[model samples]
Target: MKYRIVEQTRPGGMLAQVYREVLVPAFPPEELESEESLAETLETGLGSLLVAVDDTGRPAAAAFGHWWEASRVQMLANLAVKPGTRGHGLGGRLLRDAVDAWRERYDPCLIVAEIESPDARMVHEDYGDPRRRLGFYESAGARVLDLPYFQPGIGGASRRVQGMLLLVIHADPTFTPERLDRLSGKLLRAFITEYLAAAEGEPANDWDAKALFRAFDREGGIPMGRWGTRP
Candidate 1:
């Protein structure tokens, strides 16, 4: 079960294999970034790609995410373990490590995750069970942000995916839910605005982005919710 972390890109490296073998099969097209897009993100230094390689030198898991400087947010875009390698805690280990690495590199204030809602319609059988995925993230210390959430389309012919859950993990070691039940609405607005702008090329121009932004903007602060509940 030993694993070593390796950074990769799309230039026919191990990352290419991971995109083909793990990411492509794990995520629906709408949620998964195109390999070229991922590569560009890495190349441009806007994204980080980490692969967990087994002792046999095979990739067992992958984590890809971006650092949003405007909001000091770390966006964990995708974390997937190879299908047959589940139940051994590989996914959780990789998640923790990925967040730690990003923290050292970017010093983000918040860690954000975009997950499919457990109550939403399944994108496909291969997308896996949303409940199980939420459980995994919750067990790893992520809490859902209570907000009307939707993922902006990856452009092209893709459509926006709604009923998504926005999860957050506090960077402060002493942070507790008892101390604060909600996050700053202004900060959330910044994150959402930047995220939308990044995804849609212009946040104000995209209907879904505008609505999502307003959801956070109108709130003084956003309350946190349990993972399995609807937003």
Candidate 2:
């Protein structure tokens, strides 16, 4: 029952058994990435991965991410554990190990991930337990963002009510107005914009008008330097 967390910087290596046998079977359709598209992104340094393998050398769990090089931020593209490996704490261990390595190696400003908000009204809550996912992230010390957020419908009609909330953890929590803006507009939006655009076969842009607007609306853009005070 030995397990080891390993980094897989190349797509071909991680995407082989982990992508097909583990990740594909674990995520639902909307959350799943198209293999070709994901592989392309991986090869281009737009994505990264960390996997946990069992004693038998079979992958037990993984964390997939979309990384923005300029600002040093990563989006938790996906995280999953093999079906038979559930309840063994492998998922959390794998995530913690990856986060530790990323912080020590890359020193990213922050790592952000989106999880479905349990707004009982959304149909997606029934499909996936938002509460369960949130709890897992919270246990890992990830902050639950209060700001409005949404994930673009992947290969489907618009789904604005799915209530996707951004869960972010900072390498350092201190914030200045400039840092806040970077976190809000420059960093967060960059990853989100790329994530959605990738699915649509489009390109990532400035991210201010399109994705940011959709997440925060026009008149009131992200409140600068007010991350922790707002309700």
Candidate 3:
């Protein structure tokens, strides 16, 4: 089904409704950002929201991305489809729309996303299977970066979520092994620095954030690989 794609750079309108109905229920509390934070990003021109509205004007999927000036990257903060709208490629369509929009607007050096690592070694996770989700992103041309990743608390009642993997969904000048290896540490450190400051107030204060920054600050070039196949 062809859905209308809407771009929102500010709060109110369908943004709030979609956050309440689609995102709130689709993601776990710790994984989702507070509505206020989401709004603030949009209001401040740091982020944008793309919604796939069905024929009846109901949002079927949503993708939120924020631009990190320090890293020249656009982070795919969240990509979700309504429970009933899954398996129809709505999420992929929304993701593509987001990439296109961000590319045209920011021309970011890289478009990244945080995903649940399939190696998390858990069977009863609240969200769906990590393996399937990993497959979804990989099929979309995403390459997983080798980094010890964990999400900082998103404020409100949210806590940090660990065992996550960062993916480069899109990159400019494309990605050569040399470039990937050389910039892995530099890019990740900057990305997380900005991300941590936004979500946790102080990047150096959060243990996981600080550890990640330090670990990747001067680390060697990291390899990129597909799921179940990392070098």
Candidate 4:
């Protein structure tokens, strides 16, 4: 089947509707209505919206990214795919395209994502489970940054426990040590203030960055591939 990523405002924006109404419903109660109010939440000057379509032109999956310029990072948001169409690897394709688009427009940028803890454990457990979403990203050379924090909802409602992952795909390894340090500092601050800060009320941001760094620092760095692989 054919696959393409399109803006959410295209002629068939109904694809977004299908994802919100159909795909999101399959999430647990806690996540059921999360995207319902995204229209306003996602209205931003620097974020990108993407929808994937099947050969018949049906919407198969969708994802978005919010650009954090100070950190030279793009935080991936709202990734979802229709249940029936999930196992075919469309998710990975869509994600790769998203990364490609990011590189095309904003090269030398870092790709980041914060997923819930349960989702992470589930991904680690599944055998060839299409939900093993992180693997595709790891294979694409994304690094896992284990920032154990929760993501807050509007008005500081409830917090969703999330862990952050980073993919420095297009980084300029030639940058000076000082420049890299500055960039890393900015990214870390944004990760705290924007993502981790939003989740403040639910739980204390008790996880130390140094501890997380040691945990995720390795030869391959947390095995972003299939679950059966050695960590």
Identify the superior model by lDDT, candidate 3 or candidate 4: 3
Over 1-231, each residue of candidate 4 has an lDDT whose tens digit, in order, gives 787778652323454575555446444444323443344435545656687867877777777666666556676755677766766887777888887887777764466665443245443221223335566655766554433334444345343433534434334443213433222433454444554443344422444534544443333223332224323
Top TM-score prediction, candidate number: 3
lDDT for each candidate structure: 0.78, 0.65, 0.78, 0.52
Local accuracy of candidate 2 as per-residue lDDT tens digits, 5-107: 8877667876778878787777666767688767877889767788888888888888887776765777687888876677679878888887777777677
Off by over 4 Å in 4: 9-12, 15-18, 21-23, 26-33, 116-131, 152-158, 162-186, 196-231
**TM values, all candidates:** 0.88, 0.75, 0.88, 0.65
Candidate 1 C-alpha lDDT tens digits along 26-73: 998889888888878777777888899989988888899887878888
lDDT of 1 at 36: 87
By TM-score: ranked, best first: 3, 1, 2, 4
lDDT of 1 at 115: 92
Best by lDDT: 3
Lowest summed lDDT across 10 adjacent residues in model 4 is found at 122-131
Q: Rank the candidates by lDDT, best first.
A: 3, 1, 2, 4
Off by over 4 Å in 3: 121-126, 156-158, 174-182, 205-211, 217-220
Better of 1 and 3 by lDDT: 3
Better of 2 and 3 by TM-score: 3
Error of 2 at 175 (Å): 4.0
